[model samples]
Target: MVTEELYAKDSYIKNFSAKVTKIVPSGVILDRTAFHPRGGGLESDTGALILGGNTYRVTEVKFEGNEIVHVLEKLDGLREGDEVEGRIDWERRYRMMRLHTASHIIASIAFSKYNALITGGNITPEYAKDDFNVENKDLLPKIVEEANEIAKRGIKVKVYFLPREEAMKIPGVVKLAEKMPPELETWRIVEIEGIDIQADGGPHVSNTEEIGSIEVIKVENRGKGKKRLYYTVKP
Candidate 1:
């Protein structure tokens, strides 16, 4: 099934209409959607799926066997073939977009300056953190300062889908593990023009300047010689 990634193509899409195609035990699947699924350190989108003048609040969205399920507070009168409008809570989404973009910059800069590896990460509307293999925790302040300097450049963000064969050609793109699903013909890649690039699946702002002031707040030594850096931006 073709999942329409509204966030990838149009980060600003607030409202859209789709037909209910499948109803499962967990939720209802729409033919197309603007609701973002929970994954890649980003929270699931929350909003409403409207149909026939009735509003059903959307609580979560995810893919189930090629179908996009839009979990609701209550199913109400929603049914297959019914056309519904997918509305995103833009205020929340835009904040995530900004934070997510800031995160990429932080990781990108770290790679360039410290030769560190981002082991893991978590994202929220206002802030996000990335785990890294730092040689010296004391140098974190320098990392933050460097990341902030790059953030100030207000770099532009661009995203694209690459076929597995073509995507493997980029030096920065790392495939950490063997393919779990052979069905995935392509991978989503995020790139900061002239700076960094990674295979990622998340929403981001059009420009790095939109990230505002990224403050690297806390850095913790999480054992095994790995460190976690937490951060937020000042509006």
Candidate 2:
């Protein structure tokens, strides 16, 4: 059965109660979850599940088809139909939220200034990186400046589902050059008000102001026409 993904609706949900539906060698499957499975160039959420007064550490989370599986350090006493309380590592998750939002801001800035498209990206609590299809690495400093300017604007970030056809019509909605979002009737779109809008299914902060400031840590030349920017958000 497909797990009801609470994270998709609310990235701020840190804890949730769920009933175990299945148990595998590695982990257990829940009927619903706020734990985000690893995908979309983002890392998975890790924490603990409390069951029968015992805590099991969630080492990993991933999608097995449409089902969300929570890999545990040990299955122990968990069983089907068992109810448990799941908690996410909020400190880490929040960092990623800020980083993910910051990446979008940087991507938007790159596109606006140089017409660059996002070739790739990865998000982590420590730092985030995005690759853009641009030739000149000299624009790194300028891009960083523009990104901070936008972040200081305190733009309101909004997430909503739109019909695939309508979402595609919005310019700059699909910034990734390598792949397209899953083919679904309604696509989840994340928008930073006037700054950026793109088809995304990942956790993000409610406002750009939450991102504080982003520092460009490194710029790399990944062969012709590929420029990579690595950045970290200040607490």
Candidate 3:
């Protein structure tokens, strides 16, 4: 059976309970989970599982087809059909959440000002890098400044689902230059109030103000038409 992804609807869930549905050499599969699998440029979550007072350190989380695999440091006591309580590392997760939201703000402002589309990127607990299909490197500062300004506005961030056809109609719903959202009947949309909205599947802060100030660490030129902006969030 496919595991229920609780984070899709609520990104703030740090602790949860679920039953072990399957066990393999790689990891254990839970019936429901809040752990976000490593994908879409966002890192996987790390946490611990409690079973009969024994704690299993979850080193990595990933999606194998429809199953959510929780890779643990030791699986000695966990068994299929057993119950477990999982807790994600809040400090790390919160940092990532701030970076993720900051990335969105940067992307949105860049797109509106320069008509740039995101080519690729990575978000981690310490920093975030977003690649754009723009040749002008000088625009980086303006984009960063605008993003920080938006974050200071304290706009609320909203997440919801919409039909694929309807979502595609929005002017800038799909912001990635090379990637299209999965071919699903419905798409998950993240809207940064009146500033920006796009199709995304990662945990984010509830408001832009939670992102604090976004500081540009550096910019890299990755060949022609590709520029990556490296940044970090400061509280």
- Write model 2 residue lDDT over 1-235, tens digit each, in one string: 7799899899999999999999988899999999988998899999999997799999889988877889999987888999999999999999999999988888888887788988888988899888889999978768888888988988899999999999989998888886788889999999999989999999999999999889988999999999898889896
Worst 10 residues of 1 by lDDT: 174-183
Model 3 misplacement above 4 A: none
CA lDDT for candidate 1: 0.77
Q: In model 1, what lDDT does residue 146 have?
A: 73
Clashing pairs in 1: none
Q: Which stretches of model 2 miss by more than 4 angstroms?
A: none
lDDT against the true structure, per candidate, is 0.77, 0.90, 0.90
Highest TM-score against the true fold, candidate = 3
Q: What's each prediction's TM-score?
A: 0.90, 0.97, 0.98
For model 2, give the 10-residue run with minimal summed lDDT.
138-147
- Candidate 1 per-residue lDDT, tens place, 1-235, comes to 4757777666778999888887777778876777888877788788998887799898888767666678888876767889888889988888888888777766776777777777777887767887787757777667667767777888888888999788778876752222222446798888889877878777888888887887877889998768888888777
Model 1 ranges off by over 4 Å: 175-183
Ranking the candidates on lDDT from highest down gives: 3, 2, 1
